[model samples]
Target chain A: MLTSGIILLEGGLLNPNPGLIFWTAISFFIVMLILSKFAWGPIVSMLEEREKGIQSAIDRAHSAKDEAEAILKKNKELLARADSEADRLIREGREYADKVRTELTEKAQQESQKMIAAAKDEIEQEKRRALDVLRNEVADMAVKGAEKIIRTALDAEKQKAVVDEMIRELAASRN
Target chain B: MRVKAISRILALVVPVLLSLNSHVFAVTAQAEAPVKESATAAAPAGPATVAAPEGVAPAEATATHEAEGAEKPGEVIMHHILDNKVYPIEPFGEIHLPEIAAKPFGIDISVTKHVVMVWLACAVLLVVGLTVGASFKSLSSKESPKGMANAIEALIDFIRTDVAKSNIGHGYEKFVPFLVTVFFFILICNLIGLIPYGATATGNINVTLTLALFTFVITQAAAFKAQGVKGYLQHLTAGTHWSLWIIMVPIEIIGQFTKPFALTIRLFANMTAGHIIIYSLIFIAFILKSYVVAMAVSVPFAIFIYLLELFVAFLQAFVFTMLSALFIGLATAHEGHDDHAVEGAHH
Candidate 1:
């Protein structure tokens, strides 16, 4: 164990090998040159690019959500206005219908009363004509009967002349 | 689900063990290997009974007199844990590496097994990195990666966010490439060691120290840039009184290096130590020369440590990267940052 440290320190494993060192340095330098330029450069930038893309996508989603909300609010307001407009039009139509019904009922009642009055006046004129015709016929019949009686009575002439003169005097006095 | 996981692990482990057992039997049949095995066979007997001073004498005695085909557990353990000039191949035995004795500035730049392993790790890093990069090119910003690409992305992502950004704070982008490369490279190297007959580059102190050296250099440079020359030099005094500058400056300088020193030792020791432990456990059976111990004690315990080593592989990689980023963060952090506020609140 004691000699082991001495062995390492003096001449064995710890002995300087310049050849190995030379190879290590050259190889390391070359490896460092190629790997740095090629491998790590592209990978890092790709990661960053992906991150930026994700951020922009999130921003777009937020903006689209806000726009959709605004459209929904505008649609609700238009729906409410249409509802109130429909209600007003229905009330105006009901009032116009009631006014037309009252005017038609009053005009029908006035036309029926004028027709009844015209019929009554025509009936009164017809009654007067019939009475006049009856009266003329009766007067003609009485005159015919009186003429027959005078012809019979004139056969007893003398006695009849004296009666006629008295009758004429009575008629003149009555007039 | 538990049975299925265990079966999955068994399915991975069984083939490896069978292949390794077959290779060991094949290696024993080779010509030159048996003699070398006999030469160093006496070493394992030393660890239990003999003193460290006499550890070398028995091996020398065994090779000369007792030329039996015996294996030294210590030598085998160290050989597996340490760097060498040969890469062991499966079924064929092994290949002798080319030793380039190029002493540039009087230091041998010879290629070793660990060097080949480092190259292997770099090759792996390149394939994975370039594949991921190409996939990213085809992928739209909206699309995510799949399968292996996805797994690799998770690791790279962890390093960037958790290791680099949380530690280094501002201006962390500049260091992400370096930190990620270090993490993946160290992780691959550590895991490679876990594979049967594979050498761990991170297990070598030389390799770990070199990585730490890079961290050290970056930390100082960042400190210099973030705090100007005046501030950088002033930091060496550690905000101490003028009377304590002599003691404080040396300490502060040493403190600056200690961070990387810790990182180097942490990774190297952890990787090397786990392999040492596993080999030591397996060698217990060979040391005792018994089948019952091999079955009941050695194999089971070794497997447990092997699993633990897998976790440590990822951990050490994370620790190294974390410390590196922390040092950089400490160097670049402003005076009135949350660090000072927390410190103030503590006081």
Candidate 2:
């Protein structure tokens, strides 16, 4: 066995073959051609399509994100505008209510003052009428009482002179 | 009287010559007797007739002849370069490897070890192809790929779409497989060659030539298919002046042959040169017979070259595929006016 092994080693070293080159080339070409036809075509194209698809999807996602962000920003802006508007309306309403309240108070005070002035004037007129009527009645009653007493007490000229003299004396005393 | 005296002297000389011949025969008979006895008898012994020169031993002469026979150093170099050996049993005797036998087909052959390696390479390619195919089959709706499948797909797609379709426009689908296969096969072969004790089929000139020949055949067929025979011949003329046909035809013909030749040489030289550099660097250890020097100098240099070879393997495959696509593109290009709008539009 050892002798045979030595012989084989020696034979290999002594006679190195070159023909492997030709056969290997043939086989390689055959394999490459067949595989290229069957396997490589689909694999490569599929991969390329996949790459392109992935790239496009990424682009689409990015654009969608940008659009969503823009929309969000617009919504935020709109929300801020609405808030400002609401604040503005509230401020205007408060100012309007304040103005209305001030005007109503001024009107109420003016109406009250007019009513008090009218009542005072009516009271004064009524008091004046009552005083005038009372004065007239007192004057009439005094004259009638004086006439009756004079008629009964004296006759003719003597009576007249005495009455006149008494009347003059009373008038002077009353005065 | 003088003639008679001469005759008498001749007679005396002839008798003496005859007597001397008999004496010589007797001496020869005495020498032959021992040799004849030794020839007849099993145990008969005699001194061997073959004589060695004085002062030099027989074994020493044989040693000298052996030293002379070993003088051809080129044979030793070639043996190391080309020889593939299978060590049937390990030095420790713990493992036994199958004996490698060469199977010859006609004058040519695949060595058992190389055949096994090649078959192994092919099997690897098959698995890779099937794996990639299966991944594609089971691909999800999600766009992204992960892991080895992703990597393989990326490489395959780069070759098919980027290299093949982008270069060879129009009927690129038909050629994608060819281009991809070549790229991967060569890539695999080159990588395998980098392995210890692996034979590089692509490194051989004949291998490269056969590959180039396939390209040549394909290119010619594509041209013929794209343009009829007359148109194809006219393509060779290239719408030049009728008077210039003589010069143009030969030049074009030469160009045709040169393309494939260049392809063959480029692949063969590129692949072989890397291996040669690596082998030569590693061989320094054996040539110098110093482990320390080899470790310090050759190992580092060899490693550097090896890394370069790795890059080269990929590059060579890419270049070969690219050039093939370019050639196919050129062959199938429309005759006469150069309107590359079709190609430009695809890109």
Candidate 3:
């Protein structure tokens, strides 16, 4: 049993086995080929794709945030512009209202002055007509007084007292 | 359901029984092993053979001579460590792997213990690779991979980032598949060796040597592709003076071969040594014929080392993969990177 052949066979932990080596080479290459096709290739690309997806998503988020900020800024500017426009319109409307009010007041003052002038002219015409009527009444009274004096002759002192009494009666009648 | 269960039970039991059968082979192998007279002569039989020198006991211990009580536990240890043609089981018959002859190559391509284990390792890799690949395919770009697929992906990423990319640099993508496959294959083989009735194919020189040879060829090819033939010769000269060519060329060439050589020996010795230590520890109990030693020292120490072997399995695989990538990186590196090319090698 201790034949040199068994020792040679058993002594082979160090020695090369061409058969095993051949199989090792074949199997290893086969494994590398199969795994390259079915395993490593797909996994690596997938992981890389995932990384890219994450990165792009981050970039998209950043851009979206910037866009939102830009829109907000534009809206704020628009709000400020609209506020100024409203203030300008309100100020112009007030100015126009004040102008219209002052112009209307001046026109009212001119119209009232014309109306007062017409009233004063009418009053003057009425006063002049009344004086004419009074003057005619006074002339009629003086004729009647002279007729009475012709009917009755009086002395100089009596004529003078009669004239005074006639004047008093005329004044009372005129009042 | 019952039949399916029964088949499942058979699936588990068969390999275990088959492995136990090797012990029956061990008994017969003990009888057929070297005699006491030739023990010293056949002492240095295997490469890096340890534990046998201490076992100067006779092969035939049946005579009950006080000397015969000192039996050849070394023979038993060798029987366990060495590759065999039969997949021996105790109660059931052994499965004999067929041997084919290639007359042109002068090679015997037989299915030995290590070969079957290598195939088993390949099979394991297939299931794992396919599973991880399937998960990657099924997962949406947004969704993270889960379970064993995720674990395997982490390892793959580690190899890609730490092993291939960091070591090989720019053209690293091309070598990822090769490095990843080698890492998992070697890891599976190392772990399978730790299993009961399992053989470490990496423990075999032919296996590691063939693997190292693959690395060597790829490295050379990459160098040729990257540097061209003139550059390759220049790389062999190591940018030294023409006067130093005699000293530098041979050393540089040897250095090229020695990297793979070291890789082969490092893995082979580590895997084989762990087993040898465990077996040697157990055999010490037998050699002393003491139950106290078996319980207190032998079993405990063996168990401890076995646990350590589990860690070593992963470590050795990582080392082999890391070294392979580093070598490829070193070889394919450009002319400007003469100094910093092997910076990763220090790690």
Model 1: per-residue Cα lDDT over A1-175, one tens digit each: 3333343343266778877887788888877887778876765555557668889889999999999999999999999989898988888888788878877887777777777777777777776676566555544644554466565664666546645664574456435
- Candidate 2 segments whose C-alpha is farther than 4 A from its true place: A1-26, A29-38, A48-175, B1-77, B83-117, B335-347
Tell me the tens digit of each residue's lDDT in model 1 across B1-347.
24323434443343344334434533453455565565445333322221233455765764423322443334345556667776766455567789776677776677788998899898888898888878977888778789877888788778888999898999998888888889999999999899886899998988999999999999999999999999998888878799999998997788777778878877887787777767766766765558999999999989987898898889889888988898899888767334333323322
**Model 3 residue B339 CA deviation in Å:** 6.7
- Distance (Å) between predicted and true CA of B33, model 2? 44
- List lDDT for all candidates, in order: 0.73, 0.62, 0.76
Instruction: Please report how far candidate 3 places residue B82 from its true position, in Å.
Output: 1.7
Query: Tens digit of lDDT per residue, candidate 3, span B1-347?
Result: 24323433432343234334443434554554445425533332222222333234566333323222223444455566677676644244456788765544778888888889889999999989988898888888878888998899999989999999988998999899999999999999999999887888998888999989988888889999999999999998889899999998998888888888888877887777777677767766755558999999989988987887888899889999999898898888885545334532443
Question: How many pairs of residues collide in model 2?
Answer: 2
Top lDDT prediction, candidate number: 3
lDDT of 2 at B285: 60
**Which residue pairs show backbone clashes in model 2?**
A36-B177, A41-B177
lDDT of 3 by residue, A31-141 (tens): 899989999989999877977898999999999999999999999999999999999999999999999999999999999999999999999999889988987887787
Question: Individual DockQ of the candidates?
Answer: 0.25, 0.13, 0.27
The regions of model 3 sitting more than 4 angstroms off are A1-10, A58-175, B1-71, B90-93, B101-104, B336-347
- Candidate 1 - CAPRI tier? acceptable
- The TM-score ranking, best first, is 1, 3, 2
**TM-score of every candidate's chain A:** 0.39, 0.55, 0.52
For candidate 3, give the docking quality class from DockQ.
acceptable
RMSD, every candidate, angstroms: 12.5, 20.8, 11.3
Q: Tens digits of per-residue lDDT for model 2 on A68-160?
A: 999999999999999999999999999999999999999999999999999989988997787667655544544554576565775577666
lDDT of 2 at A147: 73
Give a tens-digit lDDT track for model 2, residues B1-347: 24323433432343233334333443444445455444323421111111112445876875433332222122222232333433112122211234435545645453544444555677778778777666665666455556877888778778777887887789887777777777777788778878865666566555566668778888899989988798789988868899999998887788778778878777765665565555555555644448997999889988987887788889888888888887788788785433234322322
